[model samples]
Target: MDNVSQITMFFLSGLNETNNHRFTLFFLTLLCYCVTLLVNISVIVTIIMDKNLHEPMYILLCTICMNGLYGTTGFYPKFLWDLLSPVHVISYSGCLVQALVMYSFACAELSILSVMAYDRYVAICRPLEYHSVMSKQRLIMLVCFSWITPFCINASNIFLTSRLKLCSQYLGRFFCVNWIIVKLACFPAQTTVNGIVADITVVIYTFHGIFIVLSYMYLIKTCANSIENRAKFMQTCVPHLTSLLTFLLTGLFSVLIMRFGSKDFPLTFKNFVSVECFVIPPLMNPLIYGFKLTRIRNRILVVLTFKTK
Candidate 1:
């Protein structure tokens, strides 16, 4: 209780091993961050500016790119600053906010992807009724649901975490996370509610993953019988699947590390595992969509060419 009362900031130990390579890491990180911003923004701008690309599919892609920005913004700036700073610490309230941003960003991403799967399913399975099913009003509602539901869930988790009486101010990882904060609680019994909430959150997103897989399964079966649908599936569904796989694999790796990571492992390796989802997904999502989607790629090329002239 006294320890919790005295703690005002958390000391991050993740950067301790990287001091010698701070400048090198900083430049590389800055370049990655900039590229992430440029590519995602390019995709987003291309979608918004082109009236022809204003369908639900393109809008979903734009939502994903926006989410990539949201998730990375929660980490990279603070991480870049930490690379140069003498001490890596964050205020109590700041830590909670970061946890909220990061968890909500990740949760919202899966929610969006699930919504995309549903959109794809309806478009491919019932083409005649696509617009009637996925009307503008409905699209707005789905988008809002994707973002808001996750935010509310994570907010509840963070609220539960905030009530814990923490014993330690030292966070082993580079950033604040609800799980880590809960782990810092002095009494094991006090964290039961937090653990339960976390488990429920995981279950919700796991269902999201299952929904995506089931949607694709039905898609494959339907597309197999039609030449045109097969081509359409190849054109659109493949990119969404690729993005979903990349995001899921990276996210699962991070979650596994957090759950089962060993202290015996090198801090540098652990740090990399901890932050891979934040780094890789932000950089990869846009590149995957940009190169794979013909409309986006052609629009981007035209924009670049026009800008140069």
Candidate 2:
């Protein structure tokens, strides 16, 4: 509580331990970012260019990849620069924007995953009504819901955060987070509205998670008794499940660390935990789908073969 004010800048303390091996870390991080872009873009382009991948499942996957790109672009560019710089500072406005992008990206991801679960449910559980249920108009609306709702929800949080008088300018994590910004507020009472809104947001997304779980549970029970549904689940739903679990695990780790992590933990470990959500899912989702989903995998392979020939 040393220099209370409306902070104009924030010093990021996550990279404090990177001085000894900054260049090496920078190289690895750059490589990771490039690979992430390559895989996500590859999946997105493959789906768009192929006529057969015009189904709701592939379209939803494409949406997920797009979100991956949107989220990672917010973090990686700033982080790579910070890795090489002597002073790691971000303008207060820039910090808020990054936080907005990060949280909205996460929430949007869960929303999209919920959509995917429903898509699979309709496909496997109600094959006769799949087309009418997941029509182009409906698909468009679902995608918009996935993206827009989270943006609006987090935007409200950021709006509330922007009004706070900060007691600190140092963010311990590598990237900006809304909760961290809220924690920096000069007065506890001023954050009452923020706390209420944040809790409501959590409950909303928690319900999304529950909906997904229930959908998949029914999917499993229905698929269990039928050989055709079992094959379909293996072919299509597995990748969705993989992506969901990856996202959930990484996101859960980040939340747990942020809420109850030990300060005695190494900065390196904390930094890794902070970025795991951004790094792993973006890179893994497309790869999981590309390798596991038959249509996408075949499309990618055919394209590669044609280019090589």
TM-score of each: 0.97, 0.97
Please write out the lDDT profile of model 2 over residues 192-292, one tens digit for every residue: 99999999999999999999999999999999999999999999999999999999999999888878889898977877897789899999999999999
CA displacement after TM-score superposition, residue 216 of candidate 1 (Å): 0.6
Clashes in candidate 1: how many? 0
Shift of residue 123 alpha carbon in model 1, Å: 1.0
What's the CA error at residue 303 for candidate 1, in Å? 0.9
Question: What would the TM-score be for candidate 1 when compared with the true structure?
Answer: 0.97
**Which residue pairs in model 2 clash with each other?**
none
Model 1, position 14: C-alpha lDDT score: 88
- Which stretches of candidate 2 lie above 4 Å from their native place? 1-5
